[model samples]
Target chain A: MIIIEILRYLFGYIEFRAFGGFPDRFVNLCTKEGIPLWNIKNAGGRITACTTIKGYLAVRGPARKSGMRCMALRKRGLIFFLKRNKKRVGILAGAAVSVALIFILSQFVWSVSVVGNTTLEDEYILSEFEKYGIKVGARISSVDLKEAAQTAVTENEKLSWAAVNRKGSVLVIEVREITVQPQMYDNSKPTNVVASEDGLILSLDILHGTAEIQPGSAVTAGDLLISGVIRHRDGSESVVHADGHVKALVKKKETFSAEDFSFYKLSYENKRKIIFFFGIKIPLGKSVPETNFSEHKSFLESGEMQLPIGIITQYGAVYSEEKTNPELSFQDKAALLGGAMYAKKLLDYSEIKTSSVTEKTDEFGKHYEFYAECEQEIGRLQEIYVEKTNDIA
Target chain B: MPKRKKQQNKRKNTPVTPFNPETKLEMLGNRELIIDGCKGIVDYGENYIKLNTGTVMTGVCGDGLLIKSFDNEIAVISGEITEISFVS
Candidate 1:
């Protein structure tokens, strides 16, 4: 119904008042003529109604026969509006130029974005994309998306899968990282199980060799816990691959000095924006080198079509990260423990049985001491490096 | 829906009427009245509106009575209707 009304509005219509004479004769004649009319009211011997433009033109003969006159009260609809504004050439030309400009701008790339990347940085992905013609202000027709995706996956070993999809004038590059599986140890050769760190043996499960260290016995790094040599009751001896899970309590200690902590006051003196258009960077004022920056971008967009022309604002914040002794807080203890865990491989080993920490902050320096006693699998496979000999001598 | 039992089932009690295209007068709770197959307008006024329905002359008495539209033998009258009478 709304669509029909719109069509009627586009075709144009008029409201008119028919007065002086037999109005009923005019209405009956108009109905017989099949001229559509609606919202008709008769007051003071005058009939007011709305009719289509075609109906109004055909209403004269009926009005003449009824001795009544219809004078158009108001004219409405699209055609009438256009006729009213036909002399405004500048406005019409401007509208035409704007539509054409939008059409032309939508043919170029407005921006580039990276997705599906957890570890790879957006700048790194975009830099890689630039090599394949996937850059802003570049012609969309010039970029070979399929070949670019293929080359990206081939060049970057970290990415297992990659795809380039176009959304209006914006280019989206999605990537999937390769998941590397842990390597398995070969057991065909003769080997011995040795301790990886200083630990007191709590439990041992020897797979193919005899347990050399007894439970509750303390052993340091490089101490053999399982021997590959297996002696039979018949007085014959043969060597086999020695594998085992040797759980032991290992103590580790790590410390952070005042030299490891530093503080920096933000220097906004080096802050300035460097605008980049397409692949070219334009400096609006004096430029300074910066270690990091935050970029904000905007482009003209109509619906999903983004215009290639846009502005990029880059802020240069100077953070020297220079070493200066400032008092260390509990956050430093976390850094100390993190360093200890990385060095001692505590998390990969096993759960901690006991832990303790001590910290000191003074004019001399800040110090953090971290200690942990954790039960870990201390058995490490060590190849038997002895030469094979048939002579007992 | 399930079939009713013999004792519970009963024949339709209302008579079925076929389609009738003669002049028909319908009143919308006395607020409006629609007269189909109207021949011509007899008198048009704020208090009274009369129409020729071939077989009878129908007069609608109301306040601020109006002929909303009249075309192709259908007259749609709307207002605060006080009475409706037909004279053969």
Candidate 2:
């Protein structure tokens, strides 16, 4: 029904009234001739109706036969519009050129983005893609997106998978980086498991080596816990690689200080804005002297598509610095203590079993000392040095 | 000829007669009447509208009666339709 209405609007329709004769006979004659009409109304001895352009022209025969007449009340549609404005050449040319400009502009990429990458920098990934003809202002129809993604993956060994997708005028490059794990020491080498810290050995499990100390033995930081020597029944000694987990009780300490706190007063300030379009930067005002500045960036976006137009705002401020005591409450001081002992860094490789804290204050600021007893894996591989001597058996 | 057969023969012989696959009248809450399979507009007036529904004449009595369209044998009449009656 909407399409019919639109067709009627596009092809042009006429609204006219028939009077002074039988209007019903005129309408029936129109239907008999296979002409379509709508919005029929009867008022004050006249029947008004709407019909298409062709129907209105052919309706003269039916009107004369029924002894009625039609006068086109209004003419509307695209054809009529063009006829009315055909003399204004400049307006028509300008409209045509604007449409053409939008078409050509949409055919080129406006922005490029990189997503789904960690460790690998966004600029580095973008540069890699730029080498493969994926960049701003490149013709989208001519660029091979799949080939670019494949070559990018092949060229960068760090990337396991990569994909390139175009969203309107914005080019999106998605990448997955390879994760490499640290390798352990070679197992064929003859080595011993030595203690990395001073502790009482809580438990010990040895693999490919002989036990040097029992669970209840106390060992220093450099003492060996697993020995690589093996004596056979024939009384001959052989050396093997040492591997073991030795859990021991270890003590750690951390300190936090507030002596570095300083306050600053603004001496002078300036705000600068730079307008950018399609990767071209144009400063809107004079550049200020370089100082400590907070920067903000915003881009013009249409829905989810980012246009290549943006603005950079810089609030440059000069300040006079002065040393001052930190304004903190008792709870704030205690919360800061949680980070003071960088000693909490031990939780990465050890579990804290017990802890104690000591606090001290000076004219500069307050200080905290954190002492903790932790269960830690103390055994680490150490190469054994031995002489190759010729012995007669 | 049988009555049904004679009617079917008349339909096949007339090409300009409106197709009568089915006659349906949908009344929208006494406000509008949409009629399908109408042969033509028999008579049109402000208080009353008459349509040939192929099998019988369908009359819609109302105030401010207007025919929205009479194309493809479908007539959509909208007004404060008070009553609808069939006149053979």
Candidate 3:
């Protein structure tokens, strides 16, 4: 318990706190070293030195004979006098600063990093590992690096295997991502092209085999869009498989404007953060005014192998709200609406091709409308019409 | 001259032990001495006797004693001597 208190006392110095009393031995040694009498203060107000060089002479009478003044000073606690003799605050601060600096220097990882992975993503792996104490600036000795790294690898599905190693202060993690191979299908078997969804036929191009449907034909689900049944002129049916690219003119209609009264506006906010140890929080500064600010926050945790040491870098969005004013021009509102729609589209898909753009204006607001056609080759699922098992049977 | 003659007679009567050039012996009392050759304890309490040339001692006795010599040179033991004889 005393040891803990001592540590706390020492740490308090780091926080710029001064505890009363001089360290007994250091003061005594300093006194013997002839470190000016005025420079010394005992635990009590003994006043070992006075500017009147003959200050020691004042005790020559009855007080000196009995040594009463010295005794009284000792009784008053000589250590406290020494404590007052000098600037206790500066000493405490210096000691604490030195200790803190040494401790931080000792605790810091000589080297930090991530390992043990391919495919799951290096950044993803590193992010998860940051929570484990194996990150940059974290004290290496105080953390169970191996345990944290291993635990992280086991918990994440994408990382099939992981191991962490520490060499000095450097943390190394070796990992293996989950492996997957697409299921191979026998392409030699004849198959027919079937409609994946019910839609009016847009366009079809049969590279090999025969087309069963024409343009503008309304087709239902499971209907054959292309047939692999090839015919022989000799009155015999030879079913040949079909393989080709099929394009369709599918119509989709969607509203492209947000309600003016309910639209969310993102206002950039700058928050100043003060970092100390593992804790981080914004202590001051504002990115946006409170009236216009909307709070948004997200947290992701990550760490090394088996250890739980990691960091959580929180994401926050502060948005501002402005009152709808008549000053906002129609053209400006149209452009903003277009930008919002485009942003929404970009968020939903990786790529978009704008086929056409249209504008609409109403009493509420102005909006830009668009009729864009996008072609995305989703998957390699071939339709089956004739079964190869039937041919063998 | 008389002291020299007496010392020579004493040497003729005493067996000469030659020490290897590398031989050395340490004694107590924090003192070190090198000898041409001397029999019996090379070092006594607080005394050190060492041989750098070629010399030898037959017996010795004391605290903290050691004997060492180069190959085929000499040896100094620590103990009291029961017999002493001069060898040609």
Candidate 4:
């Protein structure tokens, strides 16, 4: 039924009224002539009906023969509708222009986004893309995205994999950075393992070198712990990189003095004030009185497009200094000062085996002395350059 | 002459069968009626509509009888139909 209605609309139709003469005879004549008519009704001496435009034109002859006068009341359908709204041409023109604009804009990239990059900056990736002619506003058809991605991965040593994709007007570049591994010295070069610090050798393990020093041997800084020069069976010598781990007992010492100290205790007051400007906030309360307080600032972002304008809140706390008086016996005070000195010395050693503290008093001041024996790695790699000799044998 | 008279007598005794024309009538609830193979409208009023179907005449008695559509041999009638009857 809807298809028939649409067809009627396409071909155009007419709603008409007939009066006078014999209405029944008029209907019979219309049906006989195959002039389709619908929605026919009679009220008093008048008859109303709707028919196709062609039928309406053909209907006049039958209507005349039946002695009825017919008059079309209205014309309907797409053709008549267009003719009625012909003067309003701007609407149709605007629709066409908008469709063309959308098509043209979609063929070019409006923005470029970079994702999955950590150490490599977005600017660096964008610059690389620019070198390959893949930039914002560039025609999508002209850019070879696959070749661009391959170039991006190969040009940057930090990137292991890279992919480029286009979504509507946006071009996205995704990159995966290579993980860094610990540095390993070149084994092909001749190098010696030497003592990094002065100590008595506690243990030694040589994997690819001759031992230059034995356990319990005293050595100073820069002394060779393992020799890269190897003695062959034929009384000849060959140089290879030395690899070894040497643990040594190193001694550390420090001195401290008993003194009055001042410590800062920090507390925050809840009082705050906020001033907003263009979605950004400027806090205008009391400033921190001392430098010992911690400050926390938070920024609130706005809009789905992530506009730079946002609210900023600054939280501050003030610190007040409290002087402390020493309330310890003579020996206890000396031990307290000695512990402080030992803590400072411990940073230089990996592990402390034993320690001792001593105190002395003089006219200058009361002093505490501390000493500790620490175990630490003492081997350091040093490259050896050997001159090339003509004798290959 | 006797055979001719018997034939005439047989013809005279036979009953005349009316022409049976194809007519389709569809009623939706008590609100609308669609008549196909309609020949013409015999009578039309606010409360009643009578249609000619060649062999028989169909009449619809309603509260507000209206012809929604009529084209070719089809007619769509809509109203509060109270009764439908055929007049031979």
Candidate 5:
């Protein structure tokens, strides 16, 4: 189709009609100008001459000499070039055939891609598309891509939202998987105090169950903070596990350090671009001018053209990345560690946080230390202290 | 540069006859100019109009009229003047 437009523009073909005796005068004038006489065709009373720009000038003199009037078959300034001495019959037929072929090929699907699929594989999603006749090389114009995509997304119980996009020759199927939490069940089992971490208990509170330890109590791993038991007024005892949480204070001590070497540098580079014909890449821009460049690229294959409906053609760009890293100074290192310490504080509410520092500056480098006392929540177990008769409330 | 030379040659060739309403001056190259009643050529960048030889016709050259000599050649660009009668 594009080739035909280019040919038509290059050839500058125009149709001209003459009334009265202008046609014969024009033919005679053109013949005198070295133009072959057989090139002029007589259609009805109007004579159409396929001649070059030079031949058109040859007819100008005779046109002025004779009072015969002439008008171009097409509008003025519309024709770019007129093909001199070429057969027009076969040219028109060939153009029609080419346009028809392009129109027909535009109705089919060429490729399908699935994105955002973690547990569900791309093959599985494509198989679902096949069930709806949305596979590669299928006629996409006739299929409802939205309906099929919605049905496919709902088919999986894990998917919350699904979207299908048709761009050019590529079909993009995006699925948003639904997150499910573990189901909780009601059970009648003894609730024991479980140690969240290996820490010594500093304080404890017992509202219903018996107190297992007092303040400043030293406890090891998995030491019970409170006992889940009940004493009735009838001199009878009924032991029931706690259903609510209890509060406690514990001291946690941890130490960490590193004496490793790290290097810093900057990166600079150029990335390449790809040229495509139809839906295929033809490797256009590869050899770049520089080195030491970090590059990342993403391709978009979705519906930009609608002939084959949801089929998309992939167009991509390469992004060259540049990074800079500088060596840390004494102040800069302290500031960096200060931000890290703040982040650590956000993770846990430390009661008393402190840092012990020692600096050694030589040809190598310098280092420091950071220590913190973190106050955190530790779970406790409690039971009802009321008798069985009071359980009615 | 060549175009400039051609223009200079054309100006040198055109004759400046006296304001005769009936006569017309035609220029050839820088070498020659012709009036309705006379035939002559110019030289270098000077204002002289020398006539061809062996002709009864006559006209003013630089400041005065010069008669024809017998040894001059008759050519196509320079022709013999016909109907050289005085106009009122």
Candidate 6:
């Protein structure tokens, strides 16, 4: 039935009203004559039916023989529709052209994008793509992406790997740069190894300089521990950069005091509010009745695409200080303060070897003295300037 | 007397043939009727439609009867079909 309706719509059909005859005889004549007619109805001596244009034309003879008068009521289907809208021919033409244009444009690259490139610039990679004739507006069928990527990698020494891929209308080039390691120090320059801090020397492993201090030797800060000047057998000395590791035992001391009295404890209560507009904040209502409060403002962004208008949320946290008495005994307070000072002093050392803490109480307050012995690197690089001697001297 | 008996026996053994020649009538509920091998339309009306199928005349009684299609020796009549009967 759907196929028949589609055929009717495509081939075109006409609906007509028949009068002045026996409608049954008219239909019989039409059927017997092989003039296809359907949707036939009779009302008050008037008959109506629909048929294809050819069927309607062929029915004229049968209609006459049946003593029926025929008058077309309406025309339908594609042929009649095109004839009715003949004035808007340009619209159909434009639609056809746009379809063709889209098909043609999809076959070519519209834009070029570069990804995974850090040191290499987009323009540089695009320029390499241009050399391979794989830039924007290039035909996708004509471009060999594998060969282009290989060529790009071969041409640039800094690029370790490169790949060219076409994603719909975009030509993408992904590249990775070659990583270079740092160079070692120059040996021809003169440099000295000095003590980084005041410590007792533990050991020394000189790689390119003469050791001026031995184990158990005490050195102060800025004291030279190794000399970069090497005296040769020809009675002349040459300068070189010194490179070695020096380990020493350093002592650190820190003092802390605790008061045996009540202290103030601050409690933070937070409230949030949102504001719209740039840099202008209007408080909707008071969050808390506390007089002391700090507000942190942050803008809410929808996505990666930045828009000028945003929602600013102000997070206000009220800090109220309440007086509270200490809950620990005097000995416990002294031990806690001493342990805290010990940890603070240990932060400056690489490794702690031994530590001792002593607590002293006076009329002022309880005092904690913490001492720590640590092992650490004590070498600091210091450049030595050589003086040019005159030959006459 | 034996020949008459044989003729009666032959008549009893033979199968009866249908009156109409392969006319296919299909009814979809009470709303539509499709008739194949249709000869022509005998009468058309909103209340009833009579169709000729070479060997018999079929009358369809309905309200708002419409011949939806008539082609290739087939007729599709649609509407609220109440009854269908053979007039001849």
Q: For all the candidates, what are their Cα RMSDs to the real structure?
A: 11.0, 9.7, 19.8, 16.7, 26.3, 19.9
- Model 3 ranges off by over 4 Å: A1-108, A116-123, A130-132, A137-142, A181-191, A194-225, A232-243, A247-262, A266-268, A276-316, A320-330, A346-354, A359-369, A373-393, B1-88
Q: Per-residue lDDT of A279-319 in model 6, one digit per residue for the tens?
A: 23456655653445444434444453222234444444445
Clash totals for all candidate models: 0, 0, 67, 6, 23, 0
DockQ of 2: 0.46
lDDT of 4 at A285: 73
Name the 10 consecutive residues with the lowest summed lDDT in model 1 chain A: A269-278
Tens digit per residue, CA lDDT, model 5, B1-87: 699999999989999544444435454542333455322221101122233222333332232211111111221122222222222
Question: Mind giving the per-residue lDDT tens digits that candidate 4 earns over B33-81?
Answer: 9889888888766578888877888889988677776667788889899
Quote each prediction's TM-score.
Answer: 0.50, 0.55, 0.41, 0.37, 0.34, 0.40
Q: In model 2, how well does chain A match by TM-score? A: 0.56
Which docking class does model 1 fall in? acceptable
Best by TM-score: 2
Q: Which one is best on DockQ? A: 6
- What is the model-wide C-alpha lDDT for candidate 4? 0.79
Best-to-worst ranking by TM-score? 2, 1, 3, 6, 4, 5
- Chain A TM-scores, one per candidate? 0.56, 0.56, 0.47, 0.42, 0.38, 0.39
Report how large a share of the reference interface contacts model 3 reproduces.
0.00
Instruction: Residues A204-249, candidate 5: write the lDDT tens digits.
Output: 5443455665656555556666666556689886565643333334
Identify the candidate with maximal lDDT.
2
- DockQ, per model, reads 0.23, 0.46, 0.02, 0.30, 0.00, 0.48
Cand. 5 TM to true fold: 0.34
- Report the lDDT tens digits of candidate 2 across residue range A1-393: 899889888898888988877776787889889888888888866888899888999999999998988898998887887788899998789878999999998988898888999899987998899899897768889889999999989988999999998887878899999888789757878898999999888999887789989988889998989998888999998998889899998877776665533446788888889887765688877676578877687989878767878898978878888654466765565555655444345354468798766777878557776678888899988998877899999
Regions of candidate 4 where Cα sits further than 4 Å from its true position: A1-189, A200-207, A214-223, A258-279, A282-284, A287-346, A354-357, A362-364, A382-393, B1-88
Alpha-carbon local distance difference test for all models: 0.80, 0.82, 0.47, 0.79, 0.49, 0.79
| Ten contiguous residues minimizing lDDT sum, candidate 2 chain A | A340-349
Interface root mean square deviation of every model, in Å?
2.2, 1.4, 27.3, 2.4, 26.9, 1.3
State the lDDT of candidate 2 residue by residue for B6-65, as single tens digits.
999998897853434499888899888899888877877768877888767888998877
**Cα RMSD over interface residues, candidate 1:** 2.2
